[model samples]
Target chain A: MSVELISRDNGIVAVITGEIDHHAAAQIRTEIDFALERQTPSLLIFDMSGVTFMDSSGIGLILGRQRITESYGGAVAVKNPSPCARRIITLAGLSTLIIEGKKENKNEAR
Target chain B: MKHDNYFKITLPALSRNESFARAAVSAFAAQLDPTVDKIGDIKAAVSEAVTNCIVHAYADSPVVGVVEITAKIKDDTLYIKIRDKGCGIDDIKQAMTPLFTSKPEEERAGLGFAVMESCCDKLKVTSTPGKGTTVTLTVRLDKKELA
Candidate 1:
Protein backbone atom coordinates (compact mmCIF):
# COMPACT_ATOMS: atom_id res chain seq x y z
CA MET A 1 0.00 0.00 0.00
CA SER A 2 1.00 3.62 -0.62
CA VAL A 3 0.08 6.56 1.62
CA GLU A 4 0.49 10.08 0.32
CA LEU A 5 0.32 12.84 2.89
CA ILE A 6 -1.13 16.24 2.02
CA SER A 7 -0.45 18.93 4.54
CA ARG A 8 -3.01 21.68 4.83
CA ASP A 9 -3.31 24.54 7.26
CA ASN A 10 -6.23 22.81 8.97
CA GLY A 11 -5.30 19.13 9.02
CA ILE A 12 -3.37 16.42 7.19
CA VAL A 13 -5.04 14.31 4.54
CA ALA A 14 -3.65 10.83 4.00
CA VAL A 15 -4.49 9.46 0.55
CA ILE A 16 -4.03 5.69 0.81
CA THR A 17 -4.08 3.25 -2.09
CA GLY A 18 -3.90 -0.55 -2.67
CA GLU A 19 -5.16 -3.50 -0.70
CA ILE A 20 -5.15 -3.01 3.09
CA ASP A 21 -5.06 -6.51 4.49
CA HIS A 22 -2.82 -7.74 7.30
CA HIS A 23 0.10 -7.83 4.89
CA ALA A 24 -0.01 -4.07 4.34
CA ALA A 25 -1.51 -2.70 7.58
CA ALA A 26 1.79 -2.47 9.48
CA GLN A 27 3.56 -0.44 6.81
CA ILE A 28 0.57 1.81 6.28
CA ARG A 29 0.20 2.33 10.01
CA THR A 30 3.87 3.28 10.37
CA GLU A 31 3.74 5.72 7.49
CA ILE A 32 0.57 7.43 8.68
CA ASP A 33 1.81 7.57 12.25
CA PHE A 34 5.08 9.14 11.15
CA ALA A 35 3.19 11.76 9.20
CA LEU A 36 0.84 12.42 12.10
CA GLU A 37 3.74 12.88 14.49
CA ARG A 38 5.45 15.34 12.20
CA GLN A 39 2.37 17.37 11.26
CA THR A 40 0.38 17.18 14.50
CA PRO A 41 -2.65 18.56 12.74
CA SER A 42 -5.89 19.30 14.54
CA LEU A 43 -7.70 16.82 12.37
CA LEU A 44 -6.62 13.76 10.40
CA ILE A 45 -8.57 13.10 7.22
CA PHE A 46 -8.11 9.69 5.59
CA ASP A 47 -8.88 9.75 1.88
CA MET A 48 -9.89 6.17 1.28
CA SER A 49 -11.18 6.74 -2.26
CA GLY A 50 -8.11 5.10 -3.75
CA VAL A 51 -8.28 2.13 -1.39
CA THR A 52 -9.41 -0.96 -3.31
CA PHE A 53 -9.67 -3.40 -0.42
CA MET A 54 -9.72 -3.38 3.37
CA ASP A 55 -10.46 -5.77 6.21
CA SER A 56 -10.52 -5.81 10.03
CA SER A 57 -6.83 -5.01 10.02
CA GLY A 58 -7.72 -1.74 8.38
CA ILE A 59 -10.20 -1.14 11.18
CA GLY A 60 -7.46 -1.76 13.72
CA LEU A 61 -5.18 0.66 11.90
CA ILE A 62 -7.84 3.36 11.98
CA LEU A 63 -8.68 2.73 15.63
CA GLY A 64 -5.02 2.85 16.57
CA ARG A 65 -4.61 6.19 14.84
CA GLN A 66 -7.80 7.52 16.41
CA ARG A 67 -6.53 6.67 19.87
CA ILE A 68 -3.20 8.38 19.27
CA THR A 69 -4.67 11.46 17.60
CA GLU A 70 -7.43 11.81 20.15
CA SER A 71 -4.92 11.54 22.97
CA TYR A 72 -3.29 14.66 21.55
CA GLY A 73 -6.60 16.57 21.34
CA GLY A 74 -7.18 15.84 17.63
CA ALA A 75 -9.97 14.07 15.79
CA VAL A 76 -9.94 11.50 12.96
CA ALA A 77 -12.17 11.42 9.91
CA VAL A 78 -12.50 8.98 7.03
CA LYS A 79 -13.47 10.42 3.66
CA ASN A 80 -14.86 8.75 0.56
CA PRO A 81 -14.60 5.07 1.37
CA SER A 82 -15.45 2.46 -1.26
CA PRO A 83 -18.58 0.36 -0.91
CA CYS A 84 -16.68 -2.69 0.27
CA ALA A 85 -14.57 -0.65 2.62
CA ARG A 86 -17.65 1.11 3.92
CA ARG A 87 -19.28 -2.23 4.65
CA ILE A 88 -16.35 -3.39 6.72
CA ILE A 89 -16.16 -0.12 8.59
CA THR A 90 -19.85 -0.12 9.35
CA LEU A 91 -19.79 -3.73 10.43
CA ALA A 92 -17.03 -2.83 12.82
CA GLY A 93 -19.36 -0.14 14.28
CA LEU A 94 -17.22 2.76 13.12
CA SER A 95 -19.69 4.58 10.91
CA THR A 96 -19.83 7.54 13.23
CA LEU A 97 -16.13 8.14 12.79
CA ILE A 98 -16.42 9.03 9.10
CA ILE A 99 -16.98 12.55 7.86
CA GLU A 100 -17.73 13.48 4.28
CA GLY A 101 -15.30 16.00 2.92
CA LYS A 102 -16.77 19.27 1.77
CA LYS A 103 -16.28 19.74 -1.95
CA GLU A 104 -17.34 23.39 -2.09
CA ASN A 105 -15.27 24.44 0.89
CA LYS A 106 -11.86 23.02 0.22
CA ASN A 107 -10.13 25.09 2.85
CA GLU A 108 -12.32 23.87 5.69
CA ALA A 109 -10.33 21.65 8.08
CA ARG A 110 -12.98 19.75 10.01
CA MET B 1 -19.36 -35.33 -0.25
CA LYS B 2 -18.38 -34.72 -3.87
CA HIS B 3 -16.93 -31.67 -5.58
CA ASP B 4 -16.55 -30.83 -9.23
CA ASN B 5 -13.38 -28.85 -8.57
CA TYR B 6 -10.98 -28.59 -5.65
CA PHE B 7 -7.74 -26.81 -4.80
CA LYS B 8 -5.37 -26.87 -1.83
CA ILE B 9 -2.42 -24.71 -0.80
CA THR B 10 -0.14 -24.61 2.25
CA LEU B 11 1.74 -21.45 3.18
CA PRO B 12 3.65 -20.23 6.20
CA ALA B 13 1.64 -18.33 8.79
CA LEU B 14 3.14 -14.97 8.01
CA SER B 15 1.25 -11.67 8.01
CA ARG B 16 2.63 -10.94 4.54
CA ASN B 17 0.92 -13.98 3.04
CA GLU B 18 -2.57 -12.95 4.19
CA SER B 19 -3.31 -11.10 0.98
CA PHE B 20 -1.86 -13.95 -1.08
CA ALA B 21 -4.25 -16.39 0.54
CA ARG B 22 -7.23 -14.09 0.00
CA ALA B 23 -6.40 -13.56 -3.66
CA ALA B 24 -5.87 -17.26 -4.27
CA VAL B 25 -9.24 -18.14 -2.75
CA SER B 26 -11.02 -15.33 -4.60
CA ALA B 27 -9.50 -16.43 -7.90
CA PHE B 28 -10.56 -20.00 -7.28
CA ALA B 29 -14.11 -18.89 -6.45
CA ALA B 30 -14.24 -16.83 -9.64
CA GLN B 31 -14.82 -20.03 -11.61
CA LEU B 32 -18.21 -20.26 -9.91
CA ASP B 33 -19.17 -16.94 -11.54
CA PRO B 34 -20.10 -15.20 -8.29
CA THR B 35 -20.93 -11.53 -8.18
CA VAL B 36 -18.31 -8.97 -7.25
CA ASP B 37 -19.99 -8.45 -3.89
CA LYS B 38 -20.05 -12.18 -3.26
CA ILE B 39 -16.40 -12.41 -4.08
CA GLY B 40 -15.69 -9.53 -1.75
CA ASP B 41 -17.56 -11.31 1.02
CA ILE B 42 -15.54 -14.45 0.44
CA LYS B 43 -12.31 -12.48 0.45
CA ALA B 44 -13.24 -10.76 3.70
CA ALA B 45 -14.09 -14.05 5.38
CA VAL B 46 -10.89 -15.75 4.22
CA SER B 47 -8.81 -12.80 5.34
CA GLU B 48 -10.24 -13.01 8.86
CA ALA B 49 -9.51 -16.73 9.11
CA VAL B 50 -5.95 -16.32 7.92
CA THR B 51 -5.36 -13.34 10.16
CA ASN B 52 -6.49 -15.37 13.16
CA CYS B 53 -3.82 -17.96 12.41
CA ILE B 54 -1.09 -15.38 11.97
CA VAL B 55 -1.99 -13.47 15.11
CA HIS B 56 -3.40 -15.89 17.68
CA ALA B 57 -2.19 -19.31 16.55
CA TYR B 58 1.48 -18.42 16.50
CA ALA B 59 1.40 -15.84 19.26
CA ASP B 60 4.17 -17.40 21.34
CA SER B 61 6.62 -19.13 19.03
CA PRO B 62 9.48 -17.63 17.07
CA VAL B 63 9.12 -20.34 14.47
CA VAL B 64 6.37 -19.65 11.98
CA GLY B 65 3.60 -22.22 11.64
CA VAL B 66 1.90 -23.57 8.54
CA VAL B 67 -1.59 -22.57 7.29
CA GLU B 68 -3.40 -24.92 4.97
CA ILE B 69 -6.25 -23.72 2.76
CA THR B 70 -8.55 -25.97 0.79
CA ALA B 71 -11.31 -24.94 -1.60
CA LYS B 72 -13.99 -27.10 -3.09
CA ILE B 73 -16.84 -26.23 -5.43
CA LYS B 74 -19.90 -28.41 -5.84
CA ASP B 75 -22.83 -27.23 -7.93
CA ASP B 76 -23.49 -23.68 -6.74
CA THR B 77 -21.77 -23.98 -3.40
CA LEU B 78 -18.20 -23.15 -2.46
CA TYR B 79 -16.51 -24.61 0.60
CA ILE B 80 -13.30 -23.28 2.11
CA LYS B 81 -11.25 -24.70 4.96
CA ILE B 82 -8.34 -22.88 6.61
CA ARG B 83 -6.27 -24.96 9.01
CA ASP B 84 -3.36 -23.85 11.16
CA LYS B 85 -0.87 -25.95 13.11
CA GLY B 86 0.01 -23.72 16.01
CA CYS B 87 -1.16 -23.02 19.53
CA GLY B 88 -4.81 -24.00 19.44
CA ILE B 89 -7.65 -22.31 21.25
CA ASP B 90 -8.60 -23.55 24.70
CA ASP B 91 -12.18 -22.30 24.48
CA ILE B 92 -13.99 -22.31 21.15
CA LYS B 93 -17.19 -20.85 22.62
CA GLN B 94 -15.55 -17.79 24.06
CA ALA B 95 -13.34 -17.34 21.02
CA MET B 96 -16.33 -17.21 18.70
CA THR B 97 -17.96 -14.47 20.73
CA PRO B 98 -17.96 -11.10 19.03
CA LEU B 99 -15.50 -8.58 20.41
CA PHE B 100 -13.69 -11.28 22.39
CA THR B 101 -10.06 -10.98 21.49
CA SER B 102 -7.22 -12.27 23.57
CA LYS B 103 -4.85 -9.68 22.05
CA PRO B 104 -6.70 -6.51 22.73
CA GLU B 105 -3.43 -4.64 22.96
CA GLU B 106 -2.99 -5.22 19.22
CA GLU B 107 -6.24 -3.31 18.62
CA ARG B 108 -7.99 -6.42 17.44
CA ALA B 109 -11.77 -5.86 17.27
CA GLY B 110 -12.36 -9.55 17.98
CA LEU B 111 -14.90 -9.68 15.15
CA GLY B 112 -13.03 -12.18 13.02
CA PHE B 113 -15.41 -15.07 13.56
CA ALA B 114 -18.41 -12.78 13.42
CA VAL B 115 -17.38 -11.45 10.02
CA MET B 116 -16.78 -14.92 8.67
CA GLU B 117 -20.11 -16.14 10.03
CA SER B 118 -21.99 -13.22 8.50
CA CYS B 119 -20.30 -13.52 5.09
CA CYS B 120 -20.64 -17.26 4.61
CA ASP B 121 -23.66 -19.53 4.52
CA LYS B 122 -22.28 -21.72 7.27
CA LEU B 123 -19.25 -21.50 9.56
CA LYS B 124 -17.72 -24.23 11.72
CA VAL B 125 -14.64 -24.10 13.92
CA THR B 126 -12.86 -26.93 15.73
CA SER B 127 -9.67 -26.70 17.76
CA THR B 128 -7.67 -28.73 20.23
CA PRO B 129 -5.05 -27.25 22.49
CA GLY B 130 -1.50 -28.32 21.59
CA LYS B 131 -2.88 -29.72 18.34
CA GLY B 132 -4.28 -27.28 15.75
CA THR B 133 -7.36 -25.32 14.58
CA THR B 134 -9.49 -25.60 11.48
CA VAL B 135 -12.14 -23.17 10.26
CA THR B 136 -14.57 -24.30 7.59
CA LEU B 137 -16.66 -21.80 5.68
CA THR B 138 -19.40 -22.54 3.15
CA VAL B 139 -20.91 -19.97 0.82
CA ARG B 140 -23.65 -20.44 -1.72
CA LEU B 141 -22.92 -18.95 -5.13
CA ASP B 142 -25.65 -16.75 -6.63
CA LYS B 143 -24.61 -17.57 -10.17
CA LYS B 144 -27.65 -19.63 -10.93
CA GLU B 145 -30.02 -16.84 -10.02
CA LEU B 146 -28.02 -14.31 -11.96
CA ALA B 147 -27.71 -16.61 -14.95
Candidate 2:
Protein backbone atom coordinates (compact mmCIF):
# COMPACT_ATOMS: atom_id res chain seq x y z
CA MET A 1 0.00 0.00 0.00
CA SER A 2 1.04 3.59 -0.60
CA VAL A 3 0.43 6.43 1.83
CA GLU A 4 -0.31 10.02 0.98
CA LEU A 5 0.15 12.52 3.75
CA ILE A 6 -2.17 15.47 4.02
CA SER A 7 -2.16 18.14 6.66
CA ARG A 8 -5.56 18.32 8.28
CA ASP A 9 -6.65 20.77 10.96
CA ASN A 10 -4.21 19.63 13.62
CA GLY A 11 -3.69 16.04 12.64
CA ILE A 12 -2.09 14.56 9.57
CA VAL A 13 -4.16 12.33 7.33
CA ALA A 14 -2.61 9.28 5.72
CA VAL A 15 -4.63 8.12 2.75
CA ILE A 16 -3.49 4.56 2.15
CA THR A 17 -4.38 2.54 -0.92
CA GLY A 18 -3.88 -1.06 -2.12
CA GLU A 19 -3.58 -4.34 -0.29
CA ILE A 20 -1.79 -4.54 3.04
CA ASP A 21 0.10 -7.70 3.78
CA HIS A 22 3.44 -8.36 5.45
CA HIS A 23 5.40 -6.77 2.63
CA ALA A 24 3.08 -3.84 2.14
CA ALA A 25 2.71 -3.30 5.88
CA ALA A 26 6.43 -2.72 6.19
CA GLN A 27 6.35 -0.10 3.50
CA ILE A 28 3.23 1.63 4.86
CA ARG A 29 4.69 1.57 8.35
CA THR A 30 7.88 3.15 7.13
CA GLU A 31 6.12 5.86 5.21
CA ILE A 32 3.75 6.72 8.04
CA ASP A 33 6.46 6.57 10.66
CA PHE A 34 8.74 8.74 8.59
CA ALA A 35 6.00 11.31 8.43
CA LEU A 36 5.07 10.96 12.06
CA GLU A 37 8.64 11.35 13.14
CA ARG A 38 9.14 14.32 10.90
CA GLN A 39 6.05 16.21 11.93
CA THR A 40 5.45 14.60 15.28
CA PRO A 41 1.87 15.74 15.06
CA SER A 42 -0.49 15.41 17.98
CA LEU A 43 -3.01 13.46 15.94
CA LEU A 44 -2.91 11.14 12.94
CA ILE A 45 -5.73 9.73 10.87
CA PHE A 46 -5.56 6.63 8.71
CA ASP A 47 -7.86 6.62 5.69
CA MET A 48 -8.18 3.05 4.51
CA SER A 49 -11.24 3.33 2.28
CA GLY A 50 -9.20 2.28 -0.72
CA VAL A 51 -7.66 -0.77 0.89
CA THR A 52 -9.04 -3.80 -0.92
CA PHE A 53 -7.78 -6.35 1.57
CA MET A 54 -6.08 -6.61 4.93
CA ASP A 55 -5.08 -9.32 7.35
CA SER A 56 -3.24 -9.33 10.65
CA SER A 57 -0.43 -7.51 8.99
CA GLY A 58 -2.70 -4.52 8.79
CA ILE A 59 -3.50 -4.94 12.45
CA GLY A 60 0.18 -4.94 13.25
CA LEU A 61 0.58 -1.79 11.23
CA ILE A 62 -2.15 0.04 13.15
CA LEU A 63 -0.98 -1.25 16.50
CA GLY A 64 2.58 -0.26 15.82
CA ARG A 65 1.47 3.17 14.81
CA GLN A 66 -0.59 3.49 17.95
CA ARG A 67 2.40 2.45 20.02
CA ILE A 68 4.57 5.01 18.32
CA THR A 69 2.06 7.80 18.72
CA GLU A 70 1.57 6.95 22.38
CA SER A 71 5.27 7.16 22.96
CA TYR A 72 5.19 10.75 21.75
CA GLY A 73 1.91 11.64 23.41
CA GLY A 74 0.07 11.71 20.08
CA ALA A 75 -3.16 9.99 19.15
CA VAL A 76 -4.00 7.83 16.13
CA ALA A 77 -7.37 6.99 14.66
CA VAL A 78 -8.81 5.16 11.67
CA LYS A 79 -11.18 6.68 9.13
CA ASN A 80 -13.06 5.41 6.10
CA PRO A 81 -11.80 1.81 6.26
CA SER A 82 -13.20 -0.49 3.61
CA PRO A 83 -15.53 -3.29 4.60
CA CYS A 84 -12.69 -5.83 4.68
CA ALA A 85 -10.37 -3.62 6.66
CA ARG A 86 -13.20 -2.75 9.02
CA ARG A 87 -13.83 -6.43 9.75
CA ILE A 88 -10.17 -7.09 10.45
CA ILE A 89 -9.90 -4.00 12.61
CA THR A 90 -12.92 -4.91 14.66
CA LEU A 91 -11.83 -8.54 14.96
CA ALA A 92 -8.47 -7.35 16.23
CA GLY A 93 -10.31 -5.43 18.97
CA LEU A 94 -9.19 -2.05 17.82
CA SER A 95 -12.69 -0.87 17.16
CA THR A 96 -11.99 2.01 19.49
CA LEU A 97 -9.57 3.41 16.98
CA ILE A 98 -12.29 3.74 14.40
CA ILE A 99 -13.79 7.18 14.06
CA GLU A 100 -15.37 9.51 11.50
CA GLY A 101 -15.52 6.59 9.08
CA LYS A 102 -18.80 5.31 10.42
CA LYS A 103 -20.11 8.31 12.30
CA GLU A 104 -19.38 10.82 9.60
CA ASN A 105 -21.14 8.73 7.04
CA LYS A 106 -24.27 8.73 9.15
CA ASN A 107 -24.09 12.47 9.60
CA GLU A 108 -23.65 13.04 5.90
CA ALA A 109 -26.65 10.90 5.13
CA ARG A 110 -28.86 12.90 7.43
CA MET B 1 -22.98 -31.18 -2.61
CA LYS B 2 -21.49 -30.12 -5.93
CA HIS B 3 -19.12 -27.63 -4.30
CA ASP B 4 -16.22 -30.10 -4.34
CA ASN B 5 -13.09 -28.19 -5.32
CA TYR B 6 -9.39 -28.55 -4.61
CA PHE B 7 -6.18 -26.71 -5.50
CA LYS B 8 -2.62 -26.49 -4.24
CA ILE B 9 0.09 -23.89 -4.69
CA THR B 10 3.74 -23.93 -3.69
CA LEU B 11 5.73 -20.72 -3.65
CA PRO B 12 8.75 -19.34 -1.88
CA ALA B 13 7.86 -17.99 1.53
CA LEU B 14 8.43 -14.38 0.67
CA SER B 15 6.59 -11.56 2.36
CA ARG B 16 5.28 -10.38 -0.98
CA ASN B 17 3.39 -13.61 -1.58
CA GLU B 18 1.28 -13.05 1.51
CA SER B 19 -1.11 -11.05 -0.63
CA PHE B 20 -1.24 -13.66 -3.39
CA ALA B 21 -1.80 -16.56 -1.01
CA ARG B 22 -4.71 -14.90 0.77
CA ALA B 23 -6.25 -13.44 -2.37
CA ALA B 24 -6.08 -16.76 -4.16
CA VAL B 25 -7.85 -18.50 -1.34
CA SER B 26 -10.49 -15.76 -1.11
CA ALA B 27 -11.11 -15.98 -4.82
CA PHE B 28 -11.51 -19.70 -4.59
CA ALA B 29 -13.77 -19.43 -1.57
CA ALA B 30 -15.88 -16.92 -3.44
CA GLN B 31 -17.33 -19.82 -5.41
CA LEU B 32 -19.33 -20.55 -2.30
CA ASP B 33 -21.06 -17.26 -2.86
CA PRO B 34 -20.35 -16.28 0.69
CA THR B 35 -21.02 -12.85 2.03
CA VAL B 36 -18.38 -10.15 1.80
CA ASP B 37 -17.84 -10.51 5.52
CA LYS B 38 -17.15 -14.20 5.08
CA ILE B 39 -14.71 -13.48 2.31
CA GLY B 40 -12.97 -10.98 4.57
CA ASP B 41 -12.75 -13.52 7.36
CA ILE B 42 -11.24 -16.20 5.13
CA LYS B 43 -8.75 -13.82 3.64
CA ALA B 44 -7.64 -12.62 7.05
CA ALA B 45 -7.11 -16.17 8.31
CA VAL B 46 -5.20 -17.20 5.23
CA SER B 47 -2.99 -14.16 5.53
CA GLU B 48 -2.11 -14.82 9.16
CA ALA B 49 -1.01 -18.38 8.40
CA VAL B 50 0.88 -17.39 5.28
CA THR B 51 2.62 -14.60 7.18
CA ASN B 52 3.86 -17.14 9.67
CA CYS B 53 5.62 -18.99 6.89
CA ILE B 54 7.21 -15.92 5.34
CA VAL B 55 8.31 -14.33 8.60
CA HIS B 56 9.08 -17.28 10.84
CA ALA B 57 9.03 -20.57 8.95
CA TYR B 58 11.96 -19.65 6.71
CA ALA B 59 13.54 -17.23 9.14
CA ASP B 60 17.25 -17.47 10.02
CA SER B 61 17.68 -19.97 7.21
CA PRO B 62 20.12 -19.57 4.38
CA VAL B 63 17.53 -20.14 1.70
CA VAL B 64 14.00 -18.91 1.37
CA GLY B 65 11.87 -22.00 1.68
CA VAL B 66 8.61 -22.89 0.00
CA VAL B 67 5.15 -22.69 1.54
CA GLU B 68 2.53 -25.05 0.24
CA ILE B 69 -1.10 -23.97 0.31
CA THR B 70 -3.69 -26.60 -0.37
CA ALA B 71 -7.37 -25.70 -0.42
CA LYS B 72 -10.35 -28.03 -0.61
CA ILE B 73 -14.07 -27.50 -0.34
CA LYS B 74 -16.46 -30.29 0.65
CA ASP B 75 -19.79 -30.28 2.35
CA ASP B 76 -19.69 -26.51 2.08
CA THR B 77 -16.73 -26.34 4.43
CA LEU B 78 -13.47 -24.77 3.26
CA TYR B 79 -10.29 -26.45 4.43
CA ILE B 80 -6.94 -24.85 3.85
CA LYS B 81 -3.47 -26.05 4.69
CA ILE B 82 -0.44 -23.77 4.71
CA ARG B 83 2.69 -25.88 4.94
CA ASP B 84 6.33 -24.90 5.15
CA LYS B 85 9.51 -26.93 5.44
CA GLY B 86 11.46 -24.73 7.76
CA CYS B 87 12.10 -24.24 11.45
CA GLY B 88 9.08 -25.60 13.23
CA ILE B 89 7.30 -24.56 16.38
CA ASP B 90 8.64 -26.20 19.53
CA ASP B 91 5.51 -25.52 21.53
CA ILE B 92 2.28 -25.32 19.64
CA LYS B 93 0.38 -24.08 22.64
CA GLN B 94 2.79 -21.26 23.29
CA ALA B 95 2.86 -20.25 19.65
CA MET B 96 -0.92 -20.15 19.51
CA THR B 97 -1.17 -18.05 22.60
CA PRO B 98 -2.31 -14.53 21.98
CA LEU B 99 0.35 -11.80 22.36
CA PHE B 100 3.04 -14.52 22.36
CA THR B 101 5.18 -13.59 19.44
CA SER B 102 8.61 -15.09 18.93
CA LYS B 103 9.67 -12.06 16.92
CA PRO B 104 8.61 -9.08 18.96
CA GLU B 105 11.33 -6.94 17.49
CA GLU B 106 9.57 -6.97 14.15
CA GLU B 107 6.50 -5.50 15.84
CA ARG B 108 4.73 -8.84 15.68
CA ALA B 109 1.80 -8.79 18.09
CA GLY B 110 1.79 -12.58 18.39
CA LEU B 111 -1.87 -12.45 17.42
CA GLY B 112 -1.50 -14.35 14.18
CA PHE B 113 -3.05 -17.55 15.44
CA ALA B 114 -5.59 -15.60 17.42
CA VAL B 115 -6.77 -13.87 14.29
CA MET B 116 -6.85 -17.13 12.41
CA GLU B 117 -8.89 -18.81 15.10
CA SER B 118 -11.25 -15.87 15.33
CA CYS B 119 -11.85 -15.72 11.61
CA CYS B 120 -12.36 -19.42 10.91
CA ASP B 121 -14.50 -22.11 12.43
CA LYS B 122 -11.53 -24.30 13.38
CA LEU B 123 -7.75 -24.05 13.42
CA LYS B 124 -5.31 -26.98 13.59
CA VAL B 125 -1.57 -26.79 13.77
CA THR B 126 0.84 -29.70 13.31
CA SER B 127 4.58 -29.41 13.25
CA THR B 128 7.86 -31.24 13.77
CA PRO B 129 10.44 -29.09 15.55
CA GLY B 130 13.16 -29.50 12.94
CA LYS B 131 11.04 -30.36 9.96
CA GLY B 132 8.25 -27.91 9.25
CA THR B 133 4.77 -26.72 10.16
CA THR B 134 1.31 -27.15 8.69
CA VAL B 135 -1.62 -24.93 9.64
CA THR B 136 -5.11 -25.95 8.71
CA LEU B 137 -8.04 -23.59 8.78
CA THR B 138 -11.65 -24.66 8.33
CA VAL B 139 -14.63 -22.46 7.65
CA ARG B 140 -18.22 -23.62 7.39
CA LEU B 141 -20.10 -21.62 4.78
CA ASP B 142 -23.55 -20.10 5.08
CA LYS B 143 -25.64 -21.11 2.16
CA LYS B 144 -28.04 -18.29 2.90
CA GLU B 145 -27.32 -14.58 2.63
CA LEU B 146 -28.07 -11.74 5.04
CA ALA B 147 -26.92 -8.28 4.20
> Mind giving the per-residue lDDT tens digits that candidate 2 earns over B66-95?
999999999789999999999999999999
- Could you give the fnat of all candidates in order? 0.71, 0.63
lDDT of 1 by residue, A1-110 (tens): 88877778768888888888877888888888898888888888888877788888888888889998998899998898878888888998999977776432335434
- Candidate 1 C-alpha error for residue A94, in Å: 0.9
- Scanning candidate 1 chain B in windows of ten residues, the lowest lDDT window is B138-147
The DockQ for candidate 2, computed on C-alphas, is: 0.60
The prediction achieving the highest lDDT against the true structure is: 1
Candidate 1, overall lDDT? 0.88
All DockQ scores: 0.73, 0.60
What are the per-residue Cα lDDT tens digits for candidate 2 across A13-32?
A: 88888888888989888888
Candidate 2 Cα deviation (angstroms), residue A14? 0.7
Clashing pairs in 1: none
Q: Give the Cα lDDT of each candidate.
A: 0.88, 0.86
